[model samples]
Target: MQISRTTLAVLVVWLAAVAAWLVVAKPDMKTVQILAGEMAPATMSADGELPQRPPADADWRPLDQRVLAGWRDPYWLRWRSTAPAVQGGADRALRFSLRGASRLYWNGRPLAGNGIVGRTVAEERPGRLDIVRVLPPSAGAGTDELVVLASSQHQGLRLLSADAFAVVAPAELLYGQAMLPWLIAAFATGALAAAYLYFLAVQRGRRRRPGARLLLALCAVGLALPMVEGWRALVGYAYPWHGPRLFVLLGLHMAAAMLLPAYLARHFGLSVPMGVRIAYPATLVAVAAFMPGFDARSAAVLLLSLLASAGLLLRVQGAQEERGPILALVLAGALAMAVAHSAFLDGPYFLLLAILMGFLLLRHAAHLRALDRHNAKLREERAQLSLQLLQRGIHPHWLMNTLTCLQELIEQAPPRASRLVESLAEQFDRLRDSSTRQSVSLEDELALCRSHLDIVGLASDHPLSLQVEADDTRLSLPPGILHAQIENALTHAGTGACAQHPFRLRVRRDNDRWTLELRSARGSAPHRGRGTGTRYIEASLATAYPDGWRFVQGVDGADWCGRIELTCAS
Candidate 1:
């Protein structure tokens, strides 16, 4: 899509925000988890200290796999595993992202502690959710057992498991924690801005398009995504919040999945069956319920949504053959990116969605332009119809004048009267054919002029000739305008004067401007102010060319002259 000044400004602001955040937070990191996953529980001493020897308890279970017993006020969890190879240096550390305050022990030696861990609620102090403690250089590969004495007496969220502890370099842990909030904030800001802009556009439009609501829905989804996925980074809630956080994330995913098909259906002017809508969400919930983890549930929902939207798009591909395949490709690419990353609502995912939104905005702008053009054409047509109706009102008076001439001719000379009759008939035929039209060719108008002169000349005793000066007779002008001008000149000038010189007609073109001039020999009949014919000529020009045309008439030297100047649209 073509970016407007407002969008460019928004982009510049977003970039500035990101730059400022990077400068402030200074987090450069990677998702390199050297050691992370389920840690089996082991027995610890009554004093919340590590045992000198390994626990022989066969009841060891993955911390994340089993819910901790609620009755155990002060919990002592232990795990033993072969340490992974790492550079033995002062930079190495253990990162603990836990719900409750806790102290750690590495290989039976005191490592570090966060806040205060006690057996009772009054003795415990809440700590920062993320804690990083430097490891001694000797504790790298030599470390064998890790013990955690955690108490959930002051947890905001009642988390049951402590499986977020990981081994990493202190810099990496700090960087990851610092970078997360910035990333989430940046994307969330962008999504919110996009949603506000779309909302404003929808509100300002005189006629809302079919895709308008769909765009708003997409923006809403985009805004919700970063907020849902990155709430932890923004707010350091206790680890217990993870459960509710995952629930909210899964719910948003399912809602977005259902929203996609509906958005597509509405955008493409297709009707979605109520059954399909109901079944899709039911299916998503059913599948998500059986999923083992939040990541799996999220990925499944994304894939199902992709398939559902694609199914609808493809089913109606026959109606929108050109757009269907392209939309499918974009949807497939977006879903694939999202599914590939366990944290599906990340920066890259939103970037793809922004691109898709831009494309849709461009299409909507094009559609609006097309509608504007169509409306303009309709207005022009209505004006033409109105002009034609006005011209019809003048026909009765004109016919009476002609019949009077015919009556005079029949009594003066029956032989010439027949020719006048034919000319009158031909004039009526051409006028009937041209009346329903907006414009007629210059040649057709000239023929009409010649027919009018014939009927007048044959009826009156004066034989007249029409002097033409023009090139490119195929040019078009409002129908019957030239004919009307000729009739006006004859009726006002009193044919006795026009019998001295033939009427003059000229057509000229210069670039996009067109000029038509008609001059009649001055008659003794005094010029009368604007007549019905004059009003008719003025109205026709105003209707056809609006403000793009000028009309002027007066007696110039020895002749009466009328000039029409207009700019033709390209």
Candidate 2:
């Protein structure tokens, strides 16, 4: 799994959120202890004198007391402090328990609670005493007071008692201690995300394998959720119950881990086993149970599942040739997270995972691009071979052979042969001129047909008849394509047989296509024979007029007839 730029940006936001939580809502642990202990007791005075007993809720009077802050629910309140007339240190801490949900504040500073506690709508006892350090008399005398605010959505607070004691140093406060792990987690997750995003951007332009993008997306999501939850936890936004949020966080972590093996298998082209599919999801479920009273048994289950999944991935990597870099990245990220979890080091582990994913994505993309280029080259070579074959079929040898036969006839029959010679010369001249062109006018082809008939008339004892009923001015054809059809008719209508039965040629044009029909008797009982000339004509028609040409041959009574239909070229 690779991390993209978007994922890194998301992690950065999560880090910033955690930082903000630490700054704005962090509890003043030092002040909370002092106010809870000494200031709370001194503030229970009437005017400048000590009160007879704790003030009643309805008859409580607002008096000038020592400056003390109290945190309850989400609110904080502060009041003046005053010393008690009695020199007793019996009340050193303020104790209260919330029936539903509440916060405590002392000296205008909110005390960070252990997050939401107690079960949903479940009855529970109140006044769970939390120890606190007392404030000095000079720090605001005895005028301080403790305040507790209850959640309107749940239950109210029940007051327990107060106490007084010497204040502890700021260094010993719970604020810093609680924040340490969160900060570490943020750093680790952020680093992993950054690395992954960079790799994804660099490789996005290249070709990639199927599911590569999806794998990257899943890895990115997994890395992101942990950072978000860790930040919330650090800021005291996380629920103390740890039933739902913890489960979700653990699930996200497991999902991200599971995606790792699958991603590596695809990136490095390793085969994934069937067991891995079942084990990965099961691992996530096991880890998710951690939030809902997960014990040693649940932890063992999670551990065993993870071990099996890791073994499967390792086996797949070992079977492949290119597994070193991918395996190293996965192992390093996993080890870093493991160490952080054990030590409660809160930082951005996602960042590391992201970087590893980016590397895999880039490798896969490059491989796909190379394969595409190879396939393209092969296609080009195939096209070139096909062109060479076409060139051989239409060479000039056939034309030269026909010209040699016409030359011998010119000297044998002086007058008739001279006419035949002129026609042959005109037909060859036109063919030569149009050799480089794909099409010519239909009128031109008709003239060429007349010339062909003249040459046949001179060579054979039989008469050659031609009837062209066409709007020649509006018609045209591929240069050499139609000529082959005429040649086929002449070749198949044998000269000796044609003396008894004359050969006939007819041409008609309609719409954009022209049709040619030739008829000649066999002079004896018709017998089927190979027609090489016809095959050549059909092949030429197919090559030149691919979209619109048809040739048909059949016996009509005593005559062997061949018909050709072709669309006129524009």
Candidate 3:
């Protein structure tokens, strides 16, 4: 029951999302409905004083279900509170909407007002549509009398008023209203920020691509949409500027429209069409500019449809990586959201961010996979290097002979013993360096090979000589292959420890191939047993030049011949 790092991270993210949802949605708080009826006007008096009771013959009507359902005009409402105002303390506030110009009163006391009410379009003034008024704690609770005077008059409007609204706990009302969008916005912002930095950190590495930077930008800007809206909800949509949120929403939406097609085009390696690249956002601007006859949301949706269509085309074009699939899913989600609204996904942030974060996670998964492969390859190469280093001790089978020869040299000939010691030290050093590198220069390899032959000559009665006939050029090849061949020749050639048989090494290159030939005077056939030398050489060749090398291990007509032919990779 060990959880992978990815799963653990996902779980932690889920927990955070849930916690944020709880805080944003305020699920535990109860909403007490403070008002739920149509409004009536107070009795008028000559002294400009309002009466406490409504006149019997006053023109009062319950907000018609049809009218309230399709409300789009100014409305005045008077509600008698059923409970004390600000029952949960001044920390609570009233939450409702009154479009155009409006004023509110509590028990004949002026509470708040936005803009000026007018009877005609020319006289009308713009005001805040959403309101949240925290009760002054100094004013004792139990005040229930509430009145709202809303006026909306414009050339495009016909109705005088629409309907009275409701009163609920500010926390409960705003939270419940905006919970889903806030959840999506918060998660998207967090995820995209992390993913953006990940790509930025690894652009020099082999994982993240350059085009993904556009996706990061898309997510970053898309995150702002729901955030702007959700913050408006959190603060009861209270703002001094008129229609600022509306303009902000349009600008962000239009930016997404522009960014979406661009990201999709770059990711799938296609050209963004002229229409989507130019006309899509252009239409949004036209609509917002013209104002009266144009439906901005509809225009925006059409532009978004262009984005979705581009994504679909990318999917059809065989761009089926994480980028393609993720783009398709997001575009499809956006379409579903447009048609189904909150039914498909609750929030705008989640709808747009779903694909962005999905793509980010896919990139993370790819990065993890690449890193694992890199680690595994490093481990395997290190193992092979250690093996090659270990092969140096294989001549220990004649260890007694070498030691006996060294003892004689030390006692009878001090000069030869010193030369042997130096050769042995140089051999170990060469082997150490060769083991650590995949390839070494021909000159260096030849030096190490001669050191091995000299060391072997000390223990054997036979003298060893080296002959290299390359065309005065230096080349690099995988180390230890030729060394391994030399070791094999010495091991199985059956040259007597005290016999005077000489060995010669020759190297020459053809037009495209390198040839290394080792000959033994005894001319023993190659060992057929499953030995380490043969396997190591074959593995190294396959790894370095899988399709361009040949290794033949057998005896020539008169000598034990082991030769390797290698062609450098193009």
Candidate 4:
């Protein structure tokens, strides 16, 4: 695929955004754990008051587990840990999660309260699942103390599990809260690219190439799969909806299996019978619908779905001995993808391909724009050339000369007069045909040159001879090029100096270059001005051979010679 300017711009912008995000949102992180809540204060000062003096080691109970799990009654935990030494003066924070209401105290002083930590079940309030409480710079260092008075909700004898509490800086939690927003932004962008590519494919309709639309469609579908799979933290939906999220993921996975095979069949010309096609997607849907209940063995459903998708692709690929150039690019791209997968172990490979597919779509759009411009230019040039051809044939000078010659020939020889008129008409017809074409075969162009010579030969006082020596008549050249050269020769050659003069046109191919040489009698000055035959030939050659061509014209001894060498496609 071509790398377009737009692709470069997008990459640059993405990199810049990443750089800016890193610079502005630099992580000031220090990880320090102060909580292994295993506590029941031996002496309580009062219900709503702190102990005047900190409790001794003998007053607290130390358990094996860090969290206060399987505990249903209201309890107060005075979590204490010696302050870890600070380095680099990094900013500190206290982050924790709990199930029930809680109030926090730093160094035995009342600080922040979340909901209401109550002694009785009736008075209890539920706390948030997650919390981040920043510690002041004056209090972050040395001998820190936190008091979390938590009450677990009692549902008969069942104990509600509570998340452990800890103190750490935001940045220390690497793929923690900060990562969610980035993932969301990345997936949102992928969705946009997918929609745009699909729109392009649909807008192009029948003009869209095989596999182009399928590639984009697969990319769009594949990108959303990871978002659905990771919605737990990425979207932060309610935990109770876990079953529905899993269902959505399985459904998407099944859809991908169908689409992947369908792309292979459509793009690689796999002869999938109608029955097989219908059965394939049907099987995927059934598998999705009947996925095993969530358990250790339930992972087999996803593994099986992957097997089906890959199985279809391999089956189709094996049937064909021939593959397209695009298939080779796909393989090469997959190889690159493998390398990246190794490097970015946690990267969502499917969504990454969406980024690549976006670039491909841009390249396709650029290609289409270039082709459209070229076609429009050709149409314009054809219209202009057609008008020029009409005027050339209807020129009053040539018509009057031909008619006058025919009148003289009628009195002298009627049969010759009829021949002259027929040749004139044939030459006019060839000119009209040549005018409509950008290129013509050497044979057809030579025929036009010969007809013109015949008509001109009849009207000239000095006889004109024509000689064409070409090894290959299969080659194509710009239309009217040879004719224009011959016209220039007739207008300026002989000069009544030579008794007899012949116009010569020679063509041959040497290696990869096609050579055409036109030689007329040498003269002191050029016969035509810049805007006439000379300019037309130059313009036509430039348009046809923008590069890889040589045009040399000068007087060689007694001949005014011009040679054009054009490079052929490799």
Candidate 5:
């Protein structure tokens, strides 16, 4: 499938985020070679020295786990593990990452200490958490000895381990470890910013879709994942917090696993079965619990969530257009997780979430735009229907009044009846011609009004006449707008009253506006509120101008007047 603009835009955002990370973190690519599986417990040491060997009674524990505990003062930790055979003349080093001040030794040969190890906080000088010592060529392929004189007297938090002490391939390897956290943190920061923008977009839209809730939830997890992944770099916590950190990280991943499917369900407007809701997270937890390591567990949870969402989407009926993009994204996420299984949580996982959330935001924006357009079209159609209804209303009332006048005149004066019939026929012809048009020139509207008045004059004893003083007659307005006003004036103002004062129409130009005023004498009849004529006038004005038009009609001194203001054409 072709990539959408939104998806491409999302990709651009993700790339920008990655670029920002690279600029800030400047990470090294070199990899560290962990030496052994375990290290002996640390014991208090008075003098900083390379031990002949680890004590016989020392308790051995896994290197990757808590290797030192219950100690507040200075101590020595030792490790003896087979080193990878160094190629002749190849550069190699010992990498140490520790929380406190430390001095180190390799194979009984003294090396530069990270910082001074002291018995008390007053004398303790904290060291760089990560340091490297180049290994001598004579250091053979057999078992290598490593000893660290470590002190935590300067540290405020009680840590369980002294961090990692391992045989690194080169100096760059130590730099990589030091920079990894920052790199992850930078990526997380960018993703976090993107998520915040996505949330703002959700808030700014006119129509908030159900998918918005899911997009927000995705953003929430997008927020948490980076924090969990880059916590070490962002916070600089001691080693003691590592276990709790992992627990929290794992907990977040589990929550995300549960949330992703729900998010997808909400996003696509699909109703998820209760079985899957219960089974999916349960399966995620079950699989994650058996994973070999925290990274594997995290990856498993994310990958499974994506696959499950894909499966759910597959069953969605009649929504192929909606289903395709999200399906592709979830599948891509699953594939990315599978490929980056080992380091998914480190940085790749954050990148994946950014891409997914970005695409969702883009799609949501597109959906909202489409919704707005649809609503606008609906409003336009409804306005057109109303205008048509008003247009249709005028014919019946005008025809009925003319026929009544013709019948009366036929009996009273046959010659006058013939003239009224001719005027009626001419008015009908004008109406038929203007019926198909949305708007007509003011000149044509005046002709129709004159014809209408001729019929009224021939039929009534007190005939009505129209007087027009227009600055320009070519100005366009909705068909029959002024004609309806005249009819209303003759009906409510009374033909007898109009016969005395005469009906007046004056059109003038002022700046960018054209003002038309209709003046007539009001009859001594009870005041009637706005009627069908006023509605027609307003609806026609709205349909014609949509904006920049005004209508007002009420008593003005001795006469009844109606005013229409139309914006001039640019």
Candidate 6:
């Protein structure tokens, strides 16, 4: 039930089609004609009579006169009457056709036919007149007269026959030409709004909040205003309106103007300044003042404020590190709307605004999809890096050292060394099996720790103890992330020193975290400079877990120790 950007775009196109139909499809002359009265040539000569001619040598010229004066220019016949005639009938129809263009007058009223004069016609010569009509019995026959005011600026003549009049009703003329299209558009827009609201409600149910829903609701409201206005124009309900309807329409327009900047800023990942929040309410008040008097100055001020807000949004959008495509979409939409607003009413500018807004909405949706994809890719890479780090940490060096010590102890004392070799081999096998995995069980890591302790104990003459307290349940941790701390302790512990020295290794797990502490007598301090082992460990932690792992090392007088804490994988 969602009204996606694509759906809105299609709706916009549909509205455009409706507008085109209204502008391009000529209305039926029979339906629009107001009266069907004949005017003799002599009768037209008198004032207050039908088909009256222009004043002798009158030189009133059409605006943009050059456009019609080109080759094969069409001409119009003009006439005037003494007073405006009111034609009355159940169906006031006056139907007629001409070659190019013609004007009409009733009782000295100049029905200019300005709408048709500027139109171009193909396959026609100059001085020809086309057929046109004005609808309903708005002009009547009591002491009233009718006239046809025609002209051919290119041909420099203004005379035509009286056979061109036809009577028609306004309601019937507009029924097919204007009102129908407007009705369809109104229904479509209503459908779109209902679907959009349904989508917002569903999202609210899932997200358990109304903020996103309210934002979308505001967007729907913005789109609805233009849709309704366009419908009104199509239906011929725009002029001579009731007071309340006009006020509501103006208020809705103001709401749309205020909502647009906020919508664009949020969509493009730009910040909306606090100043805008304060200024928008003030704009609302100014827009409300447009009632009863319709102040053009206040409207101008509101427009200027909107432009300023859009400029502020552009400034913030320019400074963003990402979201370039989204920003570009919003900027392009704003520019298109600006150009459209400045053009004439007949230029279909409102339709252009709809198109641009639809594009911006599409861009916003695409940006969100792209962000989700990027986050998924990051997660995959992290898993891969964690596995690689585990493999590197539990390498062949530790096993080789344990085997060499076992070989030496085999000759000196066979029984204890034999038991130590078995423990070392078991641990090496465990490490080999787990090195390729992303996470190893805490029990497995503890077993490896035990093997390491055996090797260190056998290699040293002094007393060395290793203890591990962890639940047997398989808690997962990256390989070698824990072992590095144990190795650092051994390297600094003076394994070849006098017999009185002692060393200890302890590992414990509590809840979701694992901690390892190693202590030894410092016969000589190891190089204080950074080592490859430490650097590798740190780098791996940074890539795999970021802030999830920590390592600390310190020397207390003659005692050297290291501690590592890591969050276990689920």
What C-alpha lDDT do the candidate models reach, one value each? 0.64, 0.48, 0.58, 0.57, 0.68, 0.48
Top of the candidates by TM-score = 1
**Cα deviation of 541 in candidate 4 (Å)?**
3.9
- Cα deviation at 411, candidate 2, in Å, is 24
Give the residue spans of candidate 2 off by over 4 A.
1-207, 233-244, 269-276, 283-287, 290-309, 316-322, 332-345, 348-352, 368-570
TM-score of structure candidate 4: 0.42
TM-scores, each model vs. reference: 0.53, 0.39, 0.44, 0.42, 0.52, 0.40
Q: What does candidate 2 score in Cα RMSD to the true structure?
A: 18.3
- Cα deviation of 146 in candidate 1 (Å)? 4.2
Question: Number of clashing residue pairs in every model?
Answer: 0, 78, 0, 0, 0, 39
lDDT of 5 by residue, 208-266 (tens): 56656666776777777777666665455544356677778888778777777787777
Which 10-residue window in model 4 sums to the lowest lDDT? 341-350
Ranking by lDDT: 5, 1, 3, 4, 6, 2
Question: lDDT for model 5, on a 0 to 1 scale?
Answer: 0.68
lDDT of 2 by residue, 1-570 (tens): 554454454445544544553454455653444433221222333354322223334233332222221222222222333343223333334433222243445544556542342223332222222333332222343545555432212323221211112233233344354455555455545665665665576556544454566576765664666565664444333122233444455555555555655565554456656786786667566555444333332333334433543555666634332354544444544454454442222233444344444444555556556655654554344334333423422346644554455566655656765776677678667655655554577677667666666666665535565565544556555454445545544555565565466556677767767787766654343433334344445545554554467888777888877778877443
Q: Which of candidates 2 and 3 reaches a greater TM-score? A: 3
Q: Pick the lDDT winner.
A: 5
TM-score of candidate 1 versus the correct structure, residues matched by position: 0.53
- Cα miss at 246, model 4 (Å)? 32
Regions of model 5 farther than 4 Å from truth: 1-34, 41-76, 80-94, 97-103, 106-144, 149-165, 176-192, 195-199, 202-205, 233-235, 282-293, 318-322, 335-342, 386-570
lDDT of candidate 6 at residue 551, scale 0 to 100 = 75
lDDT of 6 by residue, 84-115 (tens): 44556444333333323445564455654522
What candidate 1 gets wrong by more than 4 Å, as runs, is: 1-64, 68-72, 79-88, 105-129, 134-141, 144-146, 153-163, 170-199, 288-292, 318-326, 330-352, 380-570
